[model samples]
Target: MLNKTLVPQSVARKIQGMIQTGEFQSGDKIPSQREFSQQLGVSRASLREALLTLETLGLLETETGRGTFVVGGKPSSSSHMASWRYSDSYSAFDVFQTRIMLEGRITSLAAGRLAASQLDQMENLTQQMEECWARQDLLSNVEADLEFHAIIASSCSNAMLRSLYQMVREQISETQRHPIPITEPARMRASIAEHRRIIAALRAHDGLLAQREMENHILNTARCAGLAP
Candidate 1:
């Protein structure tokens, strides 16, 4: 992300806003690229970029033979924007199930592959999490949580496994903020303790323990974040 740009993010925002605000109803045909470019006061290139992003988001579906149309819209303000949600919020149970399946494999590899610097990085992330918890800041903790998991994901030996973990990290972080249990200090402290346990398991190079601890931690986090039944 540091090496990339968010310049074209605006096009996506406008299109998303239009859909969410009822400006573009589902299944409605959006203006042609040239027409929308003139209406939006943007270059044709920019409009195309925006539409392409919308397509990726599943909000707008484009057909080679037919014109583009709105397939869905963004969720309401009351809903959290899940990384894996397709315009709609994902079911907590389903999300957790997938996380267990996916992160289980990640921890299995990370246990043996974690390097010295990587351990230090994870420790640093843990410290940051503690600081955020002391401040009672959910957003801060979520950011640090993502950093910690990202370090774990990056350490796994397989490139494909690392990529999959990265993708899951997005959804996990996206769901991290404002979970029901985040309102309580006890829940926060428990989370920190669980993190410490997981880190210790990784340090011991116990793959089975590390994997179990990782899975338990994720399930606990999801529950604390109001993402579980």
Candidate 2:
């Protein structure tokens, strides 16, 4: 139980301590926001903020449908490993599992909301990815990849969804910081094709179609990462 006067940052640290001490193991679903709020005698808003802060720090993961879970590990010392150390705990599949849910919904919301300039931006990012792929520039490809997703997120009218996307995108960035073997030339090309389909769906302002296409794209990426069936 937490103190009634505990601030969110303090709550966050306490939660982190719990994970570090093995009180909460990786993949273990924690109490619901409401439950935690009551137990801590803290306002839900404070608790939510603390949770989101932990999420952004890569210490916990909040699945779209499922509740939050301890992400399993801390950042590593190795420069190349530090970014994605959280993956070792919950696994890449966990990230994709959540992404499929969040991105699919956000894409639907963004379908009818995207501006012409936003569409142009997505298209530009796609083109940049193509050039990066051609040059075997994984870093540039990753940058464009994140920007394309961020644009879709920004197009959505939901602030909560946008914040969630920002956090998830950060985690995705960690995963992308290193070149994934599964995303070789052929797969990168396939990703571009998938991006084109998603763009087409958005252009048509078909929310359902956009959602399906985005889900398909994410699922394919998850499969490539060996995180999906």
TM-score of each: 0.60, 0.61
Considering every candidate listed, which one attains the maximal TM-score? 2
lDDT of 1 by residue, 137-174 (tens): 33345567767777777777778987776666545544
Model 1, residue pairs in steric clash: 179-225
C-alpha lDDT score of every prediction, in listed order? 0.67, 0.72
User: Model 2 RMSD to the real structure?
Assistant: 12.5
Model 2 ranges off by over 4 Å: 1-84, 176-179
Q: Tens digits of per-residue lDDT for model 2 on 15-105?
A: 7777768889878998988998898787888888677656644566777898788765343211121224465566666777788888899
* Distance from true location, Cα of 108 in model 2, Å: 0.4
CA lDDT for candidate 2: 0.72
